[model samples]
Target: MSDPSTASIVSTPRAEQPTETVSPVGAPQGDRKEKPRGLLGDAWLDLRRKPLFWISALFILLFLLMAAFPQLFTSGDAVNGSLDRSLGKPSGDAWFGYDFQGRDVYARVIYGARASIVVSVLSVLGTLLVGGAMGVIAGYRGGWVDAVLSRVADVFFGLPFVLGAIVILTTFNGSGTSNSQWKIMGLVTVSLIVLSWPVVMRLMRSSVLSTKEADYIVAARALGAGTGRIVLKHLLPNCLAPLLVYGTIMVGSFIGAEATLSFLGVGLKSPVVSWGIMISESQSFIRVSPSLLFFPSLFLVLAVLSFVMLGEAVREALDPKLR
Candidate 1:
């Protein structure tokens, strides 16, 4: 019997104590909560602090610009028509001076970057495509498929890199084809790709083999994911870090290899305008004008050093073990 004034206060079911909105497993607790950057993002953050990274980056950018636009760097002609300034020392107007054939060494160095960049980039792309695919197949499929691929890779690995390059270049590019610039560069790029893909294949295969048994990968496989899904969506994203680092390093290696071949009289020949060719032509005149050997060699060394430094920086940033 409640009093009429109280109006029989029906207990309001205790207003069900407000429950914490059941958040998703990893949902942020508050508006100020921060998200983590993944491997690449974190690596980039780490790389930004390194002077070596920026120095290498600047040099690489300089070379890339030099390659993409030689005209912008200098107003003078790359090749001179006369030997009037032959073996001329580097000066104000003629920065790198004239070569034995009266060519502007400065302009030639600028233009030469194009051929090296083109060949290296093309060869790297080709190597990664061929090697990465084979590696993925070998690691994921395993068993007979893995065994067959491994044996093939071993065969290539057993072959000497320099010797293999010589044979391939000589066979593909005969004496008559020396003047054919594109043909020679193409053969060199192809030979490099053929010889280098095995390394990438082994690298990627090992990465995949270690990662395939991981929890996420196992979960993906346990679910309805197909082979293509697992590889394209899961495997590649995780495994490409090593390839990126290696590819950066390999660019320098290939550049050196191309120059070596040219110095040996089989790479980019006369009239093509590459740093290698410049070195090759200047060797005999080392005593006459050391500048001829000095300038091109300097540029080549800078380019190679830049790439190698960049690769090392990236490796340090990406590899937790380094930290």
Candidate 2:
């Protein structure tokens, strides 16, 4: 008995018809506007506009490529050497010249990137896993837990980086030889992690403490979200900016630290072929072949500065106040 006009309007609720209704409120069907980007997306937009970021990014990419594929750049073997050519200066056949051991300096430098990058990168990653987790737990569940963890972090953090590494690495004195090179490297990496994670833990804990009291977080908790869910879903994203900046800078720091340790004869020993090892070996020959000291040190500085610059750019981009 319905009127014809009314009948047409009420035709049917077919499955296909509901698709249009599912669009966001006030939005037109099949004519969606772009959704607003989140923090990282906004960060990317800001980073793109900064020349420093691009420059540092290019250097990092080249370093990474060198690390991943050293063979692509040179057919020369890093370990192969001739004592007759020892301390030879840079020439057409040997760009970086020869080391005291008579090995091609250029080849060693290229191959050295793997160890230096691996140790520094892995140490920071492990720090993140250990420190970031502990921080989340402390910040989310305060009182006794926070007090204990904070105290522990303070104790380790009290030691200077170089001093602490020397103390911890002292256990492996004269141990990393040809057969056990990788093993010693692994232990060195672990030692670095133990020494360095406290800072990251403190940073994450403070960040979480600042963010947990926000209205949205309180609302999420009030709605019956569990601790893990709240920590992972809300607290982490909001609190990650400082940690990221510090981590980037720390990578460069660790690189220099590793080099220092090697220079002191306590890091990345023989057969490891790192920039640190190269520098360590070259220090003795500086009077005879300054190129030995120069090339590796140049690369080391470049690598460290690249990471530091990248961190600076990231900090400027991520912090709205800084921007």
Candidate 3:
């Protein structure tokens, strides 16, 4: 038997309710507060958790390296193939072998990087500038501006994009004399942009239309944020993810189109070293020295495939629907 007071005290929820204890060794009250996660933190965590992102990043890095350092990897002179060593297969001296003209397959492939990068980068930039602006304007403005721009885009879209590029390059009169390498490249780039803008513009316009109606945009509006501020600061940033994804994909397409044009003799002519030009030059000797076509075509395929993979990876990373 226990004393009543003692019994009452012991039974009074002492065992049922655990006592809260403070330990100096435990996390401090101030230190225990949750820190807000940042965009970088989220992205980093996502990347670590996802395998596709890493694979995509790796390929993108590889292509960037190839594009940046052509001289380091390639052997022999890109332009001057030795006639004496013509039609040689892959040897220690020339890894990719010599072309029909005795040019190092390695050198031409490396130098071809310049043309691939040039056409893709410039064409994508032109697309972004022209299309992105139009999209923002149309999406934000709506009404007459959207109608007119949309109609114009449709008109351009009706034309065959590659054919249009060919026609323009043929007539545009480029920078280089006779061959017109620079001018033809510029012309083709511009023509592609003209046709390409509609796709980007439509994408951007759709993105903006959805983003502009979000709570943040509405809140900004209520807070007296100017149209310019809302657009540039709020809407534009949100639109970038999709645009970047598309832009990456577009690089491959643009490069392929440029190569096709060059192969057809409507693109960069002689004196300019383009993979497409190399392929075109080797068509006759394709049977005699397939190395001429194989190496350049190989590089082209790699470049295009790398970009495509990169774009898909980025899309998976950024798109909530995909995730």
RMSD of each: 5.5, 7.0, 3.6
Q: Which digits, one per residue and each the tens of the lDDT, describe model 3 over residues 155-248? A: 9889897778767776775433665567667777788898889999999999999999999999999999999999999999889888888999
Please tell me which model should have the higher TM-score, number 2 or number 3: 2
Q: Clash pairs of candidate 3? A: 81-102, 81-103, 82-102, 174-183, 175-183
Say which prediction, candidate 2 or candidate 3, comes out ahead on lDDT. Answer: 2
Clashes of each: 0, 0, 5
Compute the lDDT for candidate 2.
Answer: 0.88
Q: Which ten residues in a row have the lowest lDDT in candidate 2?
A: 172-181
TM-scores for all predictions: 0.89, 0.88, 0.86
Clashes by residue pair, model 2: none
Candidate 1 segments exceeding 4 Å error: 1-31, 176-179
lDDT of each: 0.88, 0.88, 0.82
Stretches > 4 Å off in candidate 2? 1-34
The window of 10 residues in a row where model 3 has the poorest summed lDDT is 38-47
Ranking of predictions according to lDDT: 1, 2, 3
